[model samples]
Target: MFTLSSEDNTNFTELLKAVHKIGSKTIAKHAQDVDQKARFPVESFAAIKSLNLMSAYVPVKLGGMGLNVEQISKICEVLALYCGSTAMIYSMHKIQVACIVHHCMQVDYFKNYVKKLVSEQRLIASATTEIGTGGDLLSSFCAVKESDGQFTLTKKAPVISYGEAADDLMLTARRNIDAPNSDQVGILLTKEQFQLEPISGWDTLGFRGTCSSGFIVTASASIAQVNPVPFSEILSQTMHPFAHITWASLWSGICTDAIDNARKFVKNSVRRNPDMPPISSIRLAEVTGSLNNMRNNISASIKEYTEMLIIGDSDAFTNFGFSTRINNLKISSSQMLIDIVGKAMMICGISSYRNDSELSLCRHIRDAYGASLMVNNDRILMHNATLVVMHKEAR
Candidate 1:
């Protein structure tokens, strides 16, 4: 059994140390090349799995670490700083494991799966987002009907991470075949039992190495288990927090990366040209402070939300609180990093844009654009907030 090293201290610190020791050293350096070639970071994944970090959140009774969400978020934040693609892959796996641990009816199967994942260093990811559905899992147009206790999931999931590499995929589909527009749905686990013909390639401007490809599910497979309730409720209640924290951590890591690169550029410029303007020094301080503030806010929010989850108060509404906060943080971090990177580019002049500088703020900018598009976008979140305030006023 993997015992978490931190008994009295915050688990986040320990998680950071573990990732550092697990050989995530060249993740950032390799990120550009991987993104350029659209190749998966196989070495990084292998290193993470070898350290059993992939099974960090599975219950210890199941021969896993059983760490909490706060710990997992810390590890994710660290990984994101190095490689956004690797961080995303790991986050999806963690979300799937958390869902199974909390909702699976077959306890034996769940335990055995965790054991196998830990022992064999296997990974799982989500294939829930559909191309036509517009990234909303609750409002998926994908249909799954019950015919002799077997469910067939048919949908075109675009931008699914690790589409061909995942050991299993947590897929969501609507059960209301008679009513195609109804929100009644359930989650089903599909093992490596289907084909993943890449319908669309993943040559994106950012997060390129994520291997987020579009594929179609053509065959009917055995349904592992269903939530026994509406899928929307399960997603809003159980899955939202996982998504929020994971993505928030990723953005936070990217913010750190931007800051580090900016600092290096400024420091080198100052070293070479000692007579540089004081404004450059002031701008560097401002950007560094902004990045630090965003990182602290995200880390604190993850800790608070994790406590709520562990205490069993993770209902849809309560979970939304953390979700909204994370969303806000994502937006703020992206904007800040973009401005900081732009300033850094000016400081470094044409050299920053050169291929040899290895300073690709372009990828970060694109990935940041996609971040705001995740789940509830800015307008939707604002509307939700308005509804809440109006409800409180009526009360």
Candidate 2:
């Protein structure tokens, strides 16, 4: 129900209000159960599907809401206020939608597919990481074999979040048998076209509702399923920035909720004393400051990325400077979630540590840890080290 500004579009503001209603009334109710069971947030997703937001990033001409990354990122942030797993699933889904809409929509088949996606409210998942690749998203050990206008691929993915629940899977593989591991193409395969043989379970400390299990994904589809855009271009232009920004937005939401609880704890202690403010209030102030900085950092990155896209600054997206900033945003925001939540736990004391307490941060703290491991901060830092050396200038 919150509008970013008075200048925001009236219709989208109403849409966001509707999303907030769903988040508070539906998603939050089932979040605990979903986490406890280590299962997908089916109830949360059903509410989301009711809004027909799956194609939010698709063009309006393609029969979607035609939302940009900023608006979609806001939605992710709002959803995370209620449930991190649901928010993360939605964020990942939108990232895949952006990939297809921005890169593959030039092809008629994918164009129609987006339209169909809008109509059906289909969910999409990605298989970008392979078992042998060691979490390197750009490399692929599997190849798409093409013959007689049909192509087939089999991948050993270490993790495919909600693969069983998705209506479609967008996977990466070498363009052909002769192509190198890095010469990859994204292939869109429907549920009917792919079979996932589970290779690992989803038991985890947090984000359990994501069901990010390992799988052997075997798929066959028309050769037309191969996207026209290069995988590297999609990776740099859409995947990297979108993933980092939306993810940071969601993590910000989680941190905000945790801080809100800390505020409540401090307020209660102050009410009990009635003479002087509790020392925990100082900790609350510190965490709130960090939260504000985290939010501002994410907002600045969002603004920069949005402006670059508006001006058709294609090179900036792939440039070392922007890439480094985006990577830093991910690193800082991920760490801040832990820092803010840990501080909240310290401020709230036993209440925040207890699973049954109203101010419990157990779920929030566990979920915050997953942010650092999503793509591994150390790997990104290593890449950034090389990027800084190559670029040699900061904006």
Candidate 3:
């Protein structure tokens, strides 16, 4: 589905196999507890870190495996099947890495930081949301107050996913004290560079292991710590596409697991009756069709996006058509996951509702619902509508 040379395919397959092994042996075991406790998935993430998969998004020349988005994506999908929380945390981490790799290469400071990440297998978190911005991630209420080649920032972040677990975060703020609220910059900070006093809880319906708590973030770094590119540019060129696709891939994994369970239940029922396929088989086929549609939609977007990236389409990031398409893929994937998982729940009946049932989908059903609300689908739709009104056709 994703284009890769023959040798690349072979290596990708082996890497995926290794990730699946960790998922099955480690992540799957801790999945339920992680959900039940609403705490960090220490065991699962530890195993992944041990495998040195944390740096897969870093270039091989910089000490990583040099895998592209598709390879990291497949690995994310595999992890999701075992534990949604682990998968989400992993996906967000890679998104931060993608932004850095794509936009920060020209800066020696960030270049060295990338190599440091690969060497230490460091975990990176994101701090994009602000309390005063009302969830307007593009606007910042704080700015880098600089002095003598040094800078300090005091940001009230409304949500910092996996903040306690990560060693570093790419924090977004205004470019300078005099800059407009919409003028943004990203800075790299480690534990030493920042003080995070967690001020929120993480209890939620799905992806609980992410541990997304609010924090009063205070940090300072050298002037060199700032990436020269604007935050909006980085979002349009790298962060947006990487985040949506990787997140969709993980959601697809949740859908795949639910469908497989439904298949098992329906097949077993038919075997027991031995008269004909159960009436539920119809619904099974219907949901399976939706699942296939969802997967293909995601895959095609990845392929098209990758092609544009490879061809160096200068306007690819800002093209209204491409942006609308990306938004649609996110909307479709989010909606389909809920539809597919809901049908799977109905097919299995009482058993699937029980936590002890082998076909239990309570976790999956809960996790699937996170899709639409995570980034607020209505916000995305409204943004696309405005773009549609202004987009000129290629006449």
Work out the TM-score per prediction.
0.84, 0.96, 0.96
- Summarize candidate 2's per-residue lDDT along 1-395 as a digit string, tens digits: 00111232458989999999999899999989999998899988889989988877776666777787788999999999999999999999999998887788678789889878988999999999999788888899899899999988899999999999999999999989999989999999999999999999999999999999999999988999998577998888889999999999999999989998999999999989989989999999999999999989999999988777767656667889899999999999999999999999999999999999999999999999999988999999999999998886645
Tell me how candidate 3 scores on lDDT.
0.86
- What Cα-based lDDT does every candidate model obtain? 0.67, 0.90, 0.86
- TM-score of structure candidate 3: 0.96
Candidate 3 worst ten-residue window by lDDT: 1-10
Predicted structure 1: clash tally = 0
Model 3 residue 148 CA deviation in Å: 1.4
In candidate 1, how many Å is residue 194 off? 1.8
Q: Tens-digit lDDT track for model 1 on 1-395?
A: 01123333345466577787653565665777777788888878877886788778777666667777777787888888777788877887888777766665354545556677778877776777778765556667777766886766677787678777777766776664765544645454545555676788887777777788888864365544555556565565456666766777777777767667767777776788888754567777876777677767677767666555555553533444445665566566556655655665565556656766666566665666666555546665674675556444223
Pick the lDDT winner.
2
Which runs of model 2 end up more than 4 angstroms from their true locations? 1-8
Question: Considering TM-score, which of the candidate structures 1 and 2 is the better prediction for this target?
Answer: 2
**What local lDDT score does residue 301 receive in model 2, on the 0 to 100 scale?**
92
| Per-residue accuracy of model 3 over 1-395 as CA lDDT, tens digit each | 11222123457777788888889999999999999998889998888888778888776667777787777788888899999999999999999988888788888998999888887888999999999787777899899999999999999987899899889988999999999999999899888899998888888898888899999999988989998688887887778888889999999899889988999999999999979889889989999999889878878888877776677655667788888888888888999989999999899998889999999999999888888998889999998889989886568
